[model samples]
Target: MTTEPREPRATDVLTGLLADLRAESAVLDDLVAGLAPEGWAADTPAAGWTIAHQIAHLAWTDDWAARSVRAPEAFTTETARSFGELLAAGLDPVDEGAARGAAEEPAALLARWRAGRDGLLTALAAAPGDARLPWFGPPMKAPSMATARLMETWAHGQDVADALGAVREPTARLRHIAHLGVRTAGFAFSLHGQPAPETPVRVELTSPDGELWTWGPADAADRVTGPALDFCLLVTQRRHPDELALTAAGATATAWLPIAQAFAGNPGKGRAAGA
Candidate 1:
């Protein structure tokens, strides 16, 4: 017998997303904690950024996100000040900020990160059910913001793992990242200066637990099917589409794979095939 699709409840989704966010943060914390002092200086896949830079960036972002949720006016004021300082120093805001963070002693950086993480989690948990928080791009509701945090933590954690020549076990939390990738397909296209196609595209992923997680209209003419891990890697620009086992049918779906991005920003130049 055919089973009906289970509709997601808002409360359940928010709870699950928050739990996954905490889990992701914990995993990253553990990874960094186990690293040797030299490991912090090791260069990661993102050219020029060391493991320390990755952790520092995460910390800085978490602190900003917490401020955004807890105090809008202060967030705006501090963001402008930070940006102005970066410009005055003749530094790229993101790169210079991360570098400055990385320059701190490892223990101090870790402590700052932990504090930021705690603050962000507390603020997110206390946000109103429908409250929206501003980000570098458009504003997002608490749930979406939390999911973004999870996705970034996972992606940056991959960089740290790779830098240390360590392998990470894939987890079910990847389902959220994959869902974000699919949900943002249109935004990805728009970021690349193309009008998003109107054609519906089905996404079918085999979860790490071997369960099927499907999104979009099942009968859609365009479709993407693959392992959820690979989908996450592609969306995060960690793996080239050519290096993955994903398949895309129809013009829009095919075009999307190379440019798929889960995070909000400029269209990233994805990794070269097998890089």
Candidate 2:
């Protein structure tokens, strides 16, 4: 007798994503665990950011995310204050925030990150099903917020791995990142002050587990096809388009490759080829 496949339930999906977030966090934590003081101070691929700064920024964001869910008014007040200070100083908020976070003692920074991550995860898991959390760009529900956190952790971890010349094995969890990349094509165009292409762009990715994952219309003329890992790296700005094996078939899709950003906020100066 033939058996039917089981459809994923909402709870199961969230649980799986939370597991991936925890796994990604553990990978970064283990990578940093053995680093000496000098290692923590080593500059990453992101200009002017050290390994410590990367971890600290993740911690700081996690703290705010938890607050965004648990105490929205307080979070909004604090965020406004921080933005005002950054504007008054004429400094890029992201860069200055990371720099300030880098000043903490290495051990203390790590401890703070651990606590913040734990708290954020706890809050997210227990959040009401219909609740939304505010962020710098937009309000997100539990799943989207968790996925964004996972993407950020993985992306920054890549910077640390690159800084230390460590090779990171590809994982199936990258599917989430790739999905986010494909979903944000319109937002990517909007960030560049261009009209979003009306034509849907087809994305075909070969997952690490040797399965094909696709998004968009299958018969669309514009297409991007590549390994899931490369797509994730491209969207995260961790790797330039030229450095990856990704291919684009139409003008809109081709142009999108260089400017695609899955993360929120202003468009970043993405890396140069092979940088």
Candidate 3:
């Protein structure tokens, strides 16, 4: 008997995303769990950032995300004042957050990170399905927020892996990141002071397991095609476009490859080719 798979409900989709979020976090935890105290100070690919900075940034961001879900008023008040002021003055709130978090002792930082991850999962699960959480960028629902978190986790984990000369096994979890990249085309363009095309670009990638993952119109003139890992790495600014095998078939797609950012916040300078 052939039974067709039912379309997933919104709740079910969000649940699956949350599960993947947990798995992504667990992978990073496993990567850093055995690090010595001094290992935390080792430099990662991100300039001036160390292994501890990577974990600290995750913990700090997770704490804020939980607050955004659980305490909207507080999130609003703080971001409007503290973060707004910093950004208005041309300072980076993200760098400030990372620096402050990185000052904590490694053991204490690790414990706080673990506790915050558990707390964030609980808060996200408890939030009403239609409720939008406040954030540095536009407000997002639990599912989108989970996807964003998963994207950051994997991107930063890449830095950590590079620093340690460890190779991470790509997983289906990257689908969330690729989806975010596709959805944020307009936002990415706007961040770079460029106009977003009215017509969306088609993205076709060969996934880690060799399945074709696609987004956008079937016959879009603008297209990005490549290995899914390369696309993910490009969108996250973890790898330079010149160092990757991704192909851009139109003007918009060609311009986009250089400035695509899956996560929100400031436009990244991105990586140098062969760096």
Candidate 4:
């Protein structure tokens, strides 16, 4: 005589994800909202990037996501020319976005980022549930798009937290980051020039609140087991794999740990073991 949990309706997908995205962004905003101008200029772990760069990167990417959602055809036309020019000049379009946004006055940048991300949330909510939008890597539907934004917001928020010497309380939103990490295991291998394995790898993580989260077949031969936070940080490249306690039981999972990337585009050079 037990009742099972009800499954989420299809309509709840984007609605729920957008809410999580907003909450994560708000958390980061709280961390930086009252920073002195010097705080904005402080260096983050991303080498040359300052705190301003982190927020700017989020804003810039949010704007791009809005454009893609509102107009996919136009998005393609616009990115093809601009991205090509950036690549032709040996510059990464992603870096270019951060550089440009980071140069804005702190107050102005903060305001613009708030507006841009709010606009993106609106656009995402209005999109057809099954409609695909253009992206830097693969096209994504509204829900996946929102989840990706949440993942980046949390990842970059970690950098800001580290820079400010603040300790953030890990929350349930980290579940989004953990899920993206597991989903991108194949992409990690593909990006590193290996054939993506046909078999799925089981991922079991202990969440912040002591809940268990999992992905893939329960009986899969390959497996990744760790705290959800460590897995999230590893996939986001926020910390070196060696710096975390993640365990990989099979060849594919072990190889994936070093290259796992939740974000799109080329893999980052990554951090030293204890950096």
TM-scores vs. true structure, each candidate: 0.93, 0.96, 0.95, 0.96
Model 3 Cα shift for residue 190 (angstroms): 0.9
What does the lDDT read for residue 258 in candidate 4? 88
The regions of model 3 sitting more than 4 angstroms off are 1-5, 84-91
Q: Provide the global lDDT of candidate 3 against the true structure.
A: 0.91
> How far out, in Å, is residue 251 in model 3?
1.1
Q: Model 4: what TM-score? A: 0.96
Model 3 per-residue lDDT tens digits across residues 140-177: 99999989999999999999999999999998888889
lDDT of 2 by residue, 21-67 (tens): 99999999989988999999999989889999999889888888899
The TM-score of predicted model 2 comes to 0.96
lDDT of every model, 2 decimals = 0.89, 0.90, 0.91, 0.90
Could you give candidate 4's per-residue lDDT for residues 110-136 as a string of tens digits?
A: 999999989999999999988989999
- Winner on lDDT (1 vs 3): 3
Evaluated against the true structure, the overall lDDT of model 1 is 0.89
Q: In what order do the candidates fall by lDDT, top score first?
A: 3, 4, 2, 1
lDDT of 1 by residue, 234-269 (tens): 999998788899999999999999889999878888
**lDDT of model 4 at residue 40?**
97
lDDT of 1 at 7: 87
